[model samples]
Every structure is written in C-alpha cells, then in structure tokens.
Target: MTRDTPHLWTEQKLDARYENLFGRAAGYLPENRAALDAWLDDFSRDVHERRARNAIVRHPSVADLARLIERDRIVRMYVSRMINEAHQRDCKNTVNDIPDLLDHLDCIVTSTPKYQGPTAFPMSALFTYLMMTTDGYAVFRDQGFNKALLGILREWCAHLDSKDSQEVLNQKNGWLSPAALADKKLNLQDFQINLQDPYGGFPSFNAFFHRELRKDKDVRPIDDPDDPRIIVSANDGKVVRIRRDIKRSDEFWAKGQRYSLYDMLDGSDLTDLFVGGDVFQSFLSGGDYHRWHAPVSGVVRSARVVEALMFTELEHTSGRDAGTESQVYGASVNTRGLVFIECPPPIGMVCVMPLGMTEISSVTLTVQPGDQVTKGQEMGYFSYGGSSMCLLFQKGAIEKFFPKDNTGDMEEGDPIKVNARIAQAVGDEA
Candidate 1:
C-alpha cells in the first residue's frame, strides 16, 4: 500500500519544555582565559564557544561516530559545570532550597522569563544524553543504551546500504505519514510501519515496529523512562543482562561489547554508585538515560552487547551553575550484587515473578554469591520500571525445573520493595 502523504514531523513539533532544574554540576567545557574570580563572564562566554564547537559537523562513519559520542560526553560535563555556576550565582544551600533554582534553570531551556530557546534543534537530546550518561553499566547494560537510535534509525540504516540503487535512493526515508496525527487520533494498529529490507515483500506491524519504527535518529526515550518494562531484574529469582559498547574508535567502550558495566567495577573506585550497601537503592538517571527490562522470567545463559547506533546530542547550548544541570546514577553497589538468583542460580534457574511492574521495589539478594533460588521465589523487585533482571545457561542445555518455593517477602533476609518515583515525561500519552 502506498503511503499517500506521510505526516511530516517538522522542526516545530519538538518539545521546548523548560526544565525548572537548578543545581551545581561538574564542568566539562574547554576553559577560557577569564579568571576564576570572575566566573560569570567566563562561563557565559565559554558556553557560546562550547555550543559552536559541538555544532561542528563531520562525515558519518564508524570512526567519526565514536568521536562524536565521546565529544558529546562533554555536554554532561558542561551542564554539570554550568548548573553549579547557577547555584553559586545565588546563595542557596541544602537540597530543600533547590526548587527555586530548578524553576530558574527551566527558564533557560524553555520559554523562561530570563531567556528564550537557543538555536539548537531538538533540545531534548541534551536532556536525554544527561540521563544516559548518569547510569553506570549496571543500568545502561540492559536498557538499550548502545542501541539508542533503533527506533529512528531503522529507515536510515536501509539508506546507508542502498546508496547506489536509484530506486532505493528515490524511496522516502520514512519518519511519519504527513497526516499521521491529524486531530490527535491515532490507531496504533492502523499505523503501517515497515523496515525496508532488501527483500521484495512488506512486513507485518508486529514485525515492523520492532524492526523499523525509526531509523538513524539519536536515542529518544518513550514518554516515560520506565514504560519499556526493560529493567534488568525480576520478581522471581532469575538472572538479567545489561550491555554497553561505543563506536568512537571501533574498540569496545568498556568490556568486550557484551560485558556488563557493573560486573567489572568495585565499590571503592566506583563507590559513588552504591547506596549505603543496597544495590537496588543505587540508580542512574539524568541526561537522556533510558532502561529496558526482561519480559519473562528465565535464565540468561549468554548475552551480547552490540555497538548498534550512533547519534550526537549537542551539549554546548547552555551554561551550567545556572540553567544547566546533569547527574549520573548516584550509586552503583554491585558487591551487594546488582541482582541475585538462587543457589547455583547462574544456570537453569526457574523463575515465577510476574513480567510486569507498576513500581520499583527494593531487591534483596536472598541467596549468597552462589546460592540457589526457585521460581516465583523472592529475588528482588522495584516499585516501577527502568529496572530488569536476567538469567543464563550454557548451549545445548535443556531442563525445566519446577519450584520447591512460594512467593512471599524475604524472611532470612526479609526482602523488601522500596518504591522510587525518579523521572517524569510531559505529554507522554503511554
């Protein structure tokens, strides 16, 4: 079927929501010659330079994409620095006094009283990056951080392969049907999504949305960060997987492309990520970070971290210590073990936790480093999403173990679910 008129997602449709977020963050911009005592003048001037620098364009290649992402890292750095500047501009201390500053900072991004939006297209990218960078591997691994551009890039990926084919070149890089959202009435089932594969037939919506929803766009989270049910843990005792990889230079960002960020670090050097001693208590949010959880209870025998897509977010737009702020997951305590399965839980662990979560719950590792657990047994949970778990086993494996267990609160350890309300997305209908 021919898409007569694809609803155009014009530049005007982007969100210019003012984040009334104010606080001091770390600095990541190239410093100017201005003296430290005269910080305001230095910060304002430097931000202009920073934005111009980030706006620099380069050829879109694997090597170049990696450099772009690494350069994009500065966005978080500058935002933190500038936000801190804003806090210092005013005489505010204590977490309780932050509300006014948040409002002040919101003005910087949106139609605030102090200023209007800058020339940056899609300002949300900056916010999205901040959120992504905040989460350590523990969270980022499972949440599709590396595969950030999947939704928007499906179409673009095809174009990259079909460059010489005139017919392919003539085809549209589909983003939306021109009138896809007329009157705000959308029948998701009626939405004809297709991944233009090299094949000659069209794919079903079930097959299309997952494969070709969007192509080659930067990672844009759904209306809510937790809407994807992609957290890395489950209610029943099972293992979960998280993965990370960057293409800045073709070498994997951290561990082999499939390695989890948490399993490789310790509390001493990475102490900032752990909350007291609770792994679940530790979370990463801010700067466009996102998460996904496992949909069913099963053992994660093997996993792979692929360098899926690359798109850059502009960080040099605003000043920090004023209207800009960013933070990574404050705590990542894996010694407590990010997720625990039953005795010998590493292989063939049966689980019964429901596949859905309405909130994030505190997860208690019922088993020790190598203890065993049964299906529906208390493993861990969150009052919301952005959290998930997985399990793993070797190849040629075949076994279905039933539970000698029942669902209940942890007793020997008394597992608990501490609900958290971390982020909110405006106008996210889902």
Candidate 2:
C-alpha cells in the first residue's frame, strides 16, 4: 500500500505564481488608498514584526495534528486523480486566457511538502483583511474576472465530461489513472473507492471530487429517519466555529471585524428569523468531499445564490495577514448561496449557507425550492477548490452536536461522513 512517487509542486513555482497574481491584481486597484489604506499600514507593520521574531512555525501543533487526522484520512481515502483528470479532455476549442493558472490549481490538489513548514496565517490574514478594507473584494467581483475564472473552471468541467477523460482514468499505469494517481498521494487501502468503471466509475475530476460511496453502515449512515430530532452533517469538512446567541450583527474576524445579518443574508425578508440564532461554520479543505447534503429532513422553503468576490486570500507573504486564520473572513465576503429549509414541526426553519473561496468559488444547487428532502439528501456542491459551509439554527433549536466533544475546535472536524449525525434538535421555538 505504499504510495507512488508524486509529481511535486515546488515552493519556487508557488512563489512565482503568487508574484504574478499580485502584480496583475495591483493594476486593478486605484491609486487612492481607500479607508483600508490606513488600516493596511498598521496591519503590515504588525505582520512584519511577527515574521522578524519567527512567531509562526509551519508545522502543525499537537492540536492541529489532532484535527488534521480526519483531514488526512479523508485525503487518503480518495484518489488524487480528481483534478488531474482535467487533462484528459480536449479543451483546445475553449478560450482559456490564463492557461498557466491551470497549473496553479493543479499544484493545490497535488502535493504539499511532507512538512508544511511555518504557519502562513499572518500573511493569509493580511490579504483577507485588506480585501475587506479596500473594496479589494469589489475588484475580484468584476464580471471580467469572474467570467474568465468561470471559463477556466468550465473548461476543466467540460473535459471531465469528455470520454477521453474517462479513458485516461481507466488506463493501467498512465499518469491519469486513479490507481497510479492514488499511489502518488496516499495508500488506497486506507479507504474504499468504487472501481466499477475503468476510470474508477468517475466521469471526470468533478464527478470524482463529488463521488458517492457504496452504502455502508459505518462510512456515513443516516440517523433513524423517523426520529425528527436528528441532524446530519451538511458536508464533509472541518468545523471551524460554533457559536450560540448570534445577534443581528456580529464580529467575524480577529480584533473584532463586524458583519451584519442583513449583509450575510443578502437582505432577505426572512432575515429576522435568525436574528438571535446559533451559527455553526465549517470549512472544506482541498482534499475533502465537495458535495453538500440535507442536514435535516425538511421541505426546501427557498434556495438562492449570491455573487461575491472570487479571491478572498489576497495579501502579501510577510504580514500578520499571513496567519492561518486570515482567510476566515472570506466566508462572509465570498460568493455564496443560502438554503432555507422548513422543518416539519418543533424545529421550525434552518438555514444552510455554502460559501466559495479562491478557485473553488462555484456553488451548484442540485435541489430546488419547495422540494421535499430527506435528511442527508443531496443539496449541492463546490466545483474545484476548498470552501466553507455554515448552518444557522433558530435561537435554541440545537441541543448538541454528535460525539459532543469531537468538533474541530483544535484543528478540524472528526472526519465525519456525509449523512452522519452531526447535531440534534432541541425542539425550541424559532
């Protein structure tokens, strides 16, 4: 079960990619330093000091490792061929203005040095904070940028739809083969994969990324359907934060960055429904499953998509913004969708929000409004990169999360499966 040698993405290439990206983005900003300009000065200074003192180490802490255990397990369970499968289909006819950007995407899902080195949180934080400060979010929000990025993703998606992609995946020892690809990443025996098709029964990387598993009692069994109190995980990801007594406006960032309920809900009429609710947020890593499922068996009341910034991690490498939590704010500014589900009785209404980040910004909704959905039923998925999901409960609707203490408070979630019990209803008033 040893892994095959990987085609590594070196740090040199990553830095070069960042340099090019920053240069390109800088051109889009105005010479006038908006309000965020003054803020960046303080932010930059703080980050510089931290790096000078070597405050952040690249390696995971004991806590981080504990949380990453689930993340690593999930990665080992799946093949790395999902994104690589993009190479199999013909994209010659499609217009790809940034062909090189494809390699950047490849680098992400491929290899991470065995040792991730020091935490890049400060820099990550600075970039995310800056975007929020200077309306940098607005720059990435432009249609020109979004259309181009979407076009690139669409090209990759189209390739996944091609027979050629499947043929490559079916190959015995080819680079695109899932078996061989799996060898390059992690031992395949650690988990299960349906290899019914030559290409492992996956049409493309997209299909592979969102692959469903054969029914098993352990992987992610839905709780007793008759029990209306059970709530399942909306997706396979690390729980980032869990909070009770969420107010209409709340701080979501380091040093108290504030976001309003109206802004997060896109000014919907139902905003008041969650005024004093509880909020649960989790982030999907690059290696995690992208598909989302119903957390509760309920009738879909509404589903709406919102367009927002594409790149939320837009900062330099040297500063406090480089902190690992820097991209934390991206969940609020990034393009996302909101799903309103009306629980049969005592539970009332529950809201699930899926937000996109960086290259993984596309959110696809599979279920429509008014559809009756069973707990753990398919809801939607993120297309290409890491993203986050938020579950909003009315004031006291949640009694507790499954395994109670196994949440991702330290590093990530407990590698919970789709359809697995995540929370229980308290039958409280909406």
Candidate 3:
C-alpha cells in the first residue's frame, strides 16, 4: 500500500464499517451471538451497580471490601498469566502482532493462513465486554497487575537496548525498513539524526523515534524567553479535545465517558490542585514524532510514573477503531508518566501527561523532580507505538488559546509541532 494518509471517514462510513465487522462475527459464528449479547447485558448492569454504589452515602461494609480484594487478587493473577503467555508466544513464536493472539481467547476472528493485513484491533465485542466487566475493571485498577505488565515491558526494553535489537531495526524487514519508514515521511537532512553510516545507523528504533532535531533547525521556543505568557505544543500530534473549568469529577465531553481528578492524577495529592483546571488532550499518529518536549519553562515539582491498564481504549464502546480517534476518557486508565511543572509567575503549575497505548506503553523519563527544564526540552518518550499526551493547566493560566485552525472538534485540528506556540497566558488570576 502507498504511504497512508489521514483518512477521515464520515459517520455513515464508520457506521457501515462497524456494522460489517459486527455482522461477520454474528453471521459466520452465529453461536457466539447470544453469549456476546448476554455479556453486554451483564456489563450494563455492572455499570449501573457501580454508579449506584458511587451514589451511596455510606461507606462500604468490611465484607464488601474483603470481597472486592479477593476478586482483585484473582483478576491480577489472571492478567499476569495472560501477559506471560502472550510475551512467551511473541518471543518464541515470533508472533510480534498481538491482535493475532486474541483468537486464542475466542474474542476475535482468526485466519487459516497467517493473516497479514492491518490488525483490526479493539474491534471485538468481547474485548469491549472485557473492559467494562467488573473483572476487567479490577484488573485495571490493581497496581500489582500493572506492575507485572510494566516488568515485562522493561525487560523487552532491555532487549531492545542491546546491539542485537539495533541490528534487527536496521534490517530490511525491520521497523525502520524503507517501506515501513515511508509513512513517516522522515527526511534525515531535516532532523539532527546521526549520519555516521546513513544507510544503516540509528542505534535502535527507540533512538530513531526520540531523535532530536538540529539546534538551527525547525523546532524551538518562541523568541521571547522572559514572557511567561506563551505556551507551546509539547509534541507533534492532532488536537483531540480541550475543556475548561473542569470539575473535580464529571463526565468527559465524549458521550458516556466519565473521569475524575483522582483517576487522572492517579490519586496523588496534586489532584486537588487541578480540581478546577483546564485540560488539553492531543494524540500522536503512528508516523508522528514520538518524543515529548517541555510545554513551558518551569521547575519540576514532582514526577511520577502511574501504572495503568494497557490497550484500554475508552471510545471502543462508541464503535470506533481503537487508537484511531480520541480515546475519550482513556487518559485516566492508560499507563502514563505524569510531570507537575511549576511555571514561573503568570503561568502557575501545569501537568504534562504521556499515556501509553496498546503493547508499547513503556515510558522512559529523561528528567526527574527538582530539575529545571526549558521549553522544548525533552521530558521523555514512549518506546514504541502511537500514544497520547495531555496538558493540564491551572484555571485561567492560559487566558486564550489559538489552536491554529482548531474548531474544538474531536476529529481534526491543525497539525502541531513541538515548541510551536499554541496558547497564550493571561494576566488575571484563575
């Protein structure tokens, strides 16, 4: 296929596509229909029960807490086993594609001769059912489960860091192959990438993804350094959503989506500071630059890595391709690296969050707490795969934003580059 362009399918097209995929499962495997329907019904009830409990004024009984703990323990074990099995298969069977393994769970369609088309992931009704189910929620919330997943990711990172991984990445069929790299439209001359052996360089795919640009090149902070009034885009991605005067906990703008400061901040003490803040959500495409840059010059107050579920796309219930559009309220659920930056004067504390998606959720932090960072400086990056980043500002810090051609629509926004001016600060207090 030619280099992929952004294909914005109309709502009718999306509906038709989903209906066809849903019909394939329903028609070819009629036996699974009843079970899928029954699971959806159960999930709806679980959601109702969850909301009912949230409305209850009294604290949960000790028995209820104990039962929840037991359930969590069981789910944690199951999730751990699932990760191990998947990792083993990928490493031993050379089955790099994960969606291909979903067939074993009887949750997705399988092919007789190793399928090669783009993986239609997170489209399975069973996958959606699993995410909404009580067990799935428990597995998601349990730190142990997340930690286990992280452990595997770190090990994989170690391997990728080795010379062997670099060799693989430089091979014809590797991630950096001409065919695969074509989609990115990468121009080596435009970037500060090392040309030591132009034809076969790039220490690894990780290095290529996080490659820095030349000092005299395209990306840089606006000329006015003394002005605290300017805020720049932290990464190269399309704006998905922007919200102002956010509540402590309320439904996200996306339909049927809900999130709270506690969940977004991983229940840190910093959560309260952002109860009534402004949030800007944007996501990277598969071929977009992967490194994260500092959005403002500030003191790093605190930086924490939060453990969360991977491949948990919130907008899946809306019958959209996972990771293709805004993930609605997924920032709260995906494993993320959080940084609280205390912007000088006019712009106060701001939060920069980099969330992981799919199997490439490993975050490598380049800076730590107490460090002073300048705008456009690297903060961190995802090892592989497209991910999302969020910017949370204190209420009123950003007086007004000129999101280029942004109309506040979820589908598309003006293409942004790191260090490019995106918003301006106000003189008034939030």
- Candidate No. with top TM-score: 3
TM-score of 3: 0.65
Clashing pairs in 3: none
Instruction: Quote the RMSD, in angstroms, for model 3.
Output: 13.5
| Alpha-carbon TM-score of each model against the true structure | 0.24, 0.61, 0.65
Q: Name the regions of candidate 2 deviating beyond 4 angstroms.
A: 1-144, 167-196, 216-218, 250-259, 314-327, 402-414, 427-430
Each prediction's Cα lDDT score?
0.24, 0.53, 0.56
> Can you give the lDDT of residue 10 in candidate 3?
40
Write candidate 2's Cα lDDT for 233-327 as tens digits. 88776565566766675554433223356667777788888887776666665455678899897898899888776565533332222322333
Cα lDDT for residue 271, candidate 3:
81
> Cα RMSD (Å) per model?
22.6, 16.9, 13.5
Model 1 C-alpha lDDT per residue in residues 1-430, reported as the tens digit of each score: 1211213312221111112111111111112212211333333344445445663222233233244334566433433433343333331121112232222222222210010112111212222213212221122232232332232222222322232212221113221233322313222223233325432123321122122212344222222233321122222221122111211122112222222224322212332222111111112111111122332234432222212112221122232211111111111211122332222322222221121111111222333334333222334322111222222222212122122111111111112111111111122223
Q: Provide the clash count, candidate 3.
A: 0
Clashes of 2: 25
lDDT (10s digit) by residue, model 3, range 266-332:
8778887776777787777555677898989989999988867664434334443322333546677
Candidate 2 structure, TM-score to reference? 0.61
